[model samples]
Target: MVKSKSIYSCVECGGRVLKWQGQCPHCHLWNTLVEAVAEKNSTRFNYTNEISRVQNIEKIKIGEEPRYSTGIAELDRVLGGGLVDGGVILLGGDPGIGKSTLLLQALCYSSCDRAVLYVSGEESASQIALRAKRLSLATKKVHLLTEIQLDRIQEVLGKEKPNVAVIDSIQTIYSESLQSAPGSVAQVRECAAQLTRIAKASGICIILVGHVTKEGTLAGPRVLEHMVDTVLYFEGDAQSSFRLIRAIKNRFGAVNELGVFAMTEKGLREVSNPSALFLSHHEEKVPGSCVMVTQEGTRPLLVEVQALVDKSQALNPRRLSVGLENNRLAMLLAVLHRHVGIACFDQDVFVNAVGGVRITEPGADLAVLLAIVSSLKNKPLPIKIITFGEIGLAGEVRPVQRGQERLKEAAKLGFVQAIIPKANKPKHSVFGIEIILVDRLEDAVTAIF
Candidate 1:
C-alpha cells in the first residue's frame, strides 16, 4: 500500500520545505508558505518520451513559408506579423483586461486553412459563443472544448489534430495526477511544461491565457513565464475602454511591439491611428502642456505631456508622476536645477502622460523636462510644437532613433514645429513643421521658451 505524505511549499518560489517558517529562504517573501499534499514516490506518464522518438534536432528542417496571420492587423503587428508554428505564447493581464476576448476574436477570425481548437476551463461553450457572436465571428471551423483535466485535454489534442490551440487560462487547468489543488505552483509548472512539449512536437501554435498578480505580473511561478516562446501582456485602465497588448518576450520576433484596441459595445476595435486618440484638440493653448513623439518598437506615436508645479506648504515637497518613471523625473529635476537654474525644490511637481499611455523611451525626456519647466515658469508652449530627444546628464540633447518616422507622424497630426536632435539630417525638405535642431538641454529650453 502507498503512504500519503505532507509538505509545505513556498507560495512565491514553489520550493519545498519540511515545515513552515515566518519567511521563505528561497523567495524571501514573508508568510507565503502553504501546506500542500505531497505526492509519494511516483512517476506520471511522460509525454516528452513519446515526442523524443520522433522529434530530434537533426530531423527538423527550416521552411520559407511565413507565419499564419489571425486576420487582425494590430494583433499581427504585435506578434511580429503572425503566430509562429509550434510557438507557446502566454497572455497575461489583470482580471477583465480582455485577454480571453482578444484570443477568442483571433480564433474566430483566424484564417480557416488550419484546424483550431479553443479550450476553456473557466467558461462554457455557450458563453464563449455569445462573445463570438457579439464580435461578429460566426464561424463553424473553430471548435470549442471546456475541460480542466490535463489528460483529457491531451486526449482531445491527439484526436482533434488541431493546428492551433488556446487554453483560456493556465491556473484553472489541473493535472489529475497532481495531488495539489488547481493554481498551485506544481500544477501550473507541470501543465505548462506538458503543453510546451505537445506544441513543439505537433507543430501547433498554443496560446495560454494566464492570470496576473496584484503587482500586475503573470501569476504562477516565474518558471511558467520562462517555459513559453513569447509573453504578451494586456494593459489598460479597467475603467476605460482602451487596452494595449504588448509583447514583452519573443523568441522569433522583436520585443516591445504594441497593439492598441478600443473595447466597444460590439467588440474590440483596433486603433489604426493611435496618435489621434492621445492628443486633445484644444482651441486655447494651456500652460504646463507640451507634445512629444515617442517610439514603441518600430512605430512612432505622438502624445501630449502635462505637468503642474504648485508651491508646497509641507516641509517636504511631493513629486508625483503618472505614466512616467518617478525616478527619472527626479533625476531630470536635479539636472534642471544644476544646469538650467530652475529651483523646483519648494514646489510640488506632478507629471502625467495624457491618455493613460505609459512612455518609457528616453526620447521623451526633453519633452517632460520642458513641460515641467514651462509649468513652473507659467508659460505656455507653442500650440503646434512637438519635440523628442534624449537628455544626457551633461545637459546634452542626444539624438533619438527613427527620427524620420517621428517627424512624419507629427506632421500628419497637424504639428507645425519640432525640436529634434541636431544630428538627425532630414532625408528631404518637409514643409508641415519647422524643424528646429538642438544639441543641448538649455538649447531645447531656449527653443521652447
Candidate 2:
C-alpha cells in the first residue's frame, strides 16, 4: 500500500513545498500557498517496455487539423476558424457572463451531425434543460452528465466517446488520488491535466470553463493556461448588454482575436458588424468626441473616444479613465502641455471609450489627446473624421500596425476624412476619403483645430 503525505503548493506557479508559508517562494506571490496531499509512488521500476524511435523531420507528415464550426460565427472567428479536433480551450469570465450559455448553444447546434456531451459539475441536468428550453435550443441529441468526480467523468467520456465535450467548470472537479478539496491548486492542476490527456488520446474537443479572481484574471494555477491549447477571456460589464470574447492564447490560430455578442432574453446573439456597437450616433458633431480605428486580431474596428476636462477645485486634480489606461492619459496630457501649449494642470480629466469595449493598444493615444483638446476648446471635430496613431513623450506621432487596413475600414464606414501618422501615409489614396498626414503632435493639433 502507498502512503499519502501533506504538501503545500503555490496557486500561481504550481510549485510544491513541504509546509505552508505566507508567500510562495517559487513564484514570490504572497498568500498563494495551499495545503494538498501528495500522491505516493508505489512502483519505482514500473516503466513502459515499448521502445521509442526518432524520425527525420523531413519525413514527418504535415496536414491541416480538422475543424468543426460552433454554429456561432463570432465564436468560430475567435477559435481560429472553428473547434479543432483534440483541442482544449479554457474559457474564463465573471459570474453570469454567459460562458455556459454560449457553450450550450454551440453544443446543441453541433449535435445535428456530431456526438456532443455537456458535463455540469455545478448545475443539475434539469437546470441545463431549463436553460436550453429558455434559449429555445433543441437538446434531444445533446447528452448531459452531472458529475464532479474525475474518475466518473473519465468513465463517461470513455463510454460515450463524444466528438466534443464541455466541462462546465474545471474548478469543481476533484480527483480521488488527491485529498485536498476541489478548486485547490493541486486539484485544479490534476483535473485539468487528466482532461487534456483524455481529449488528446481520444480526439475529443474539450472546453473547460474557469472562474475569475477579483482582479478579473482566471482563478487557478498559472500552469492551467499553459496546459491548454487556447485561452479565451469573456469581458463586459454586468450592466451592459454587450459582451466581448477575446483569445489571449492560441496554439493553432492567431492571438488577440475578438468575438462580439449581445445578450438578449433569448440568448447571446453574435454581432456581425462589431464596429457599429462601439460608435454613438449623435444628432450633431459633439465636442470631446473623436472616432478612432483599432485592430483586433485581423479585423479592423472603429470606436469612439470621448474626453472631458474641467477646472479642479481641490489642490490635486483627479484623472480618471474608463475603457482605457489611466496612466497613459496622464502621459498624453503632459505631452499636450509640452508640445501643443495646451495646459490642463488644474483640470479634472475623464476619458472614456464609447460603449463597453476596452482599448489596450497605444494606437488610441492620438485620438484620446484629440478628444481632450477638443473638450478643452469646446470645439467639435469636423463631422465624419477619424484618427489613429501613437503619441510619444517627445511629441512625435508614431505609426501603428496595418494603417492601410485601418483607413480602408474607416472609409467603408462612411468616414470622409482621416488624420493619421505621416509614416502611415499610403501610396494610393482610398476612394471617397481624404487623409491628412501629421508627423508631430503639434501638427495633429493644428490640423484638427
Instruction: Score each candidate by Cα lDDT.
Output: 0.87, 0.93
Backbone clash count for every predicted candidate, in the order shown = 0, 0
Candidate 1 — what's its lDDT? Answer: 0.87
Across 1-449, the per-residue lDDT of candidate 2 in tens digits comes to: 76768898887889989988998889899998877787665431222235558999999999998888999999999999999989999999999999999999999999999999999999998999999999999999999999999999998999999999999899999988777789988789989998998888779999999999999999989999999999999998889999999999999899999999999999999998899999999999889999999999989999999999899999999999999999999899999999999999999999999988889999999999999999999999999999999999999999999999999999999999999999999978899999999999999999988
Error in Å for residue 1 of model 1: 11
Model 1 residue 38 lDDT score:
86
Clashing residue pairs in candidate 2, if any?
none
Which residue pairs show collisions in model 1?
none
